[model samples]
Target: MSAEQDSVFVRNFALVIATLVGVTVLLIVIANSVFGDMDPERQALAEERAEQNLSPDFAVRLSGEPAPAIASADSGADEGGVTEVRSGEQVTQAVCIACHQGNFLNAPGIGDKAAWNERIGKGWETLTQNVADGYGNMPAQGGAASEEEIRAAIEWMVESETGLEVPES
Candidate 1:
């Protein structure tokens, strides 16, 4: 072929290759958006593989370590909540600190005057109820043992931050 024709042919071939690559990438993106992270067949295969990988004594081995102690049925444990009656400080350390200390998930930091004031104006009952019901990113009772524990934790946070008393229920 002539030089100009050869150049044209090479350019066309390059364009075709580039187009094919672009189309492949676009298809991958569309598949990810449409199919999401898990495909039913893939999930089933993964589960099967996981099961197969387990040893014959898998059940026994899994519980080899004694499970951490969960609180007893009593001690004011609410439905779908833990039984352990954790002190405000303990609860703060265990769960509240995760979000509250640094305000992760838009949580009011411990002793954030401005943040606490906004909710404090809403009244203690409303605040505690919100805690029980899981306001915003906070899971119900902030995953505390019970409503009482949740209240205590909130009170502790509020009192420490704003020096205002939140009555106990």
Candidate 2:
């Protein structure tokens, strides 16, 4: 190629290289300034960007079956779920106390931890089940009409005096 043409080509290549280098430096500087230092304005702008990117139904269910009900009358009892029972204390006082005052069936006292130590070792679930279904002299639902009454009696007896954590009904 001619010397003039070669010189022009070399100059064009150098100019292209310089322009690219300038652009790269500018991007790096812009990034460093934007990221390195934080101000309220920048923070606000980023939050705005994030908000714009987010959807109104951000927490919408994307998939999966809706969770099953914990306890419906038709659905039947929940594991460690609240039972439909109340007035347990009254029932216990009226009925259970007669037999339990003597600590029959080896069940614990009202608040005697030593007595309950073995029963508690049997676990809360077993205790609830035993009481609900009837364990020896305890009788089913403490021989009450409704499950609510049974659970209430259990909760009052176990939690109030014994310090057991009873589930809500």
Candidate 3:
């Protein structure tokens, strides 16, 4: 192309870029004008949601350190501050159901007699110990529940649900 043609092309390109920049700035200004004043309640909710989203889902604890206290919706503590133990059904629903319901990670499904039979043969003590210390794809339940609660959950998930009693060793 000739020098004149190149200059004209360059000028046109600059004008196009300038127009695009102008349009972008105009849109930004219009958007700010339209949405600059957010509703107080909406703003509060947005901030809260952002905080929740940014919060860590899990925390790390060093070995030998005391385990973090588990939070319960219905603490059910008496005047003596001794928290009432949750029932087997409740513990099963809250903790075990996540994996057991769907048989996640090859976990035995709730009420699956065949699956329970295989593990039930392992007996209550063995099963409870396995559950307490992460077994297979399952994480340890010791942090989530007391030994009694773990036993109850096992009874509910294996015996009560499957109609197969776990052998007490």
Best of the candidates, lDDT:
3
lDDT of 1 by residue, 1-169 (tens): 7999999999999999999999999999999998777978999998998997784634454746644344675745554546457787787888788899998999998988888877776777788788787888888764555777877787788786578665543
Task: Assess candidate 1 and give its TM-score to the true structure.
Answer: 0.46
Provide the TM-score for each candidate, comma-separated: 0.46, 0.39, 0.53
List clashing residue pairs in candidate 3: none
lDDT of 1: 0.77
lDDT of 3 by residue, 19-101 (tens): 99999999999999999999999999999988887765344545655544455566555343346787899999999999999
Clash pairs of candidate 2?
Answer: 84-148, 85-148, 85-149, 86-148, 88-153
**Candidate order by TM-score, highest to lowest?**
3, 1, 2
Over 4 Å off, model 1: 1-84, 167-169
Per-residue error (Å), model 2, residue 157:
1.4
Q: After best superposition, candidate 2 residue 100: deviation in angstroms?
A: 2.0
Q: Which stretches of candidate 2 lie over 4 Å from their true place?
A: 1-86, 121-125, 166-169
CA lDDT of each prediction against the hidden true structure: 0.77, 0.67, 0.85
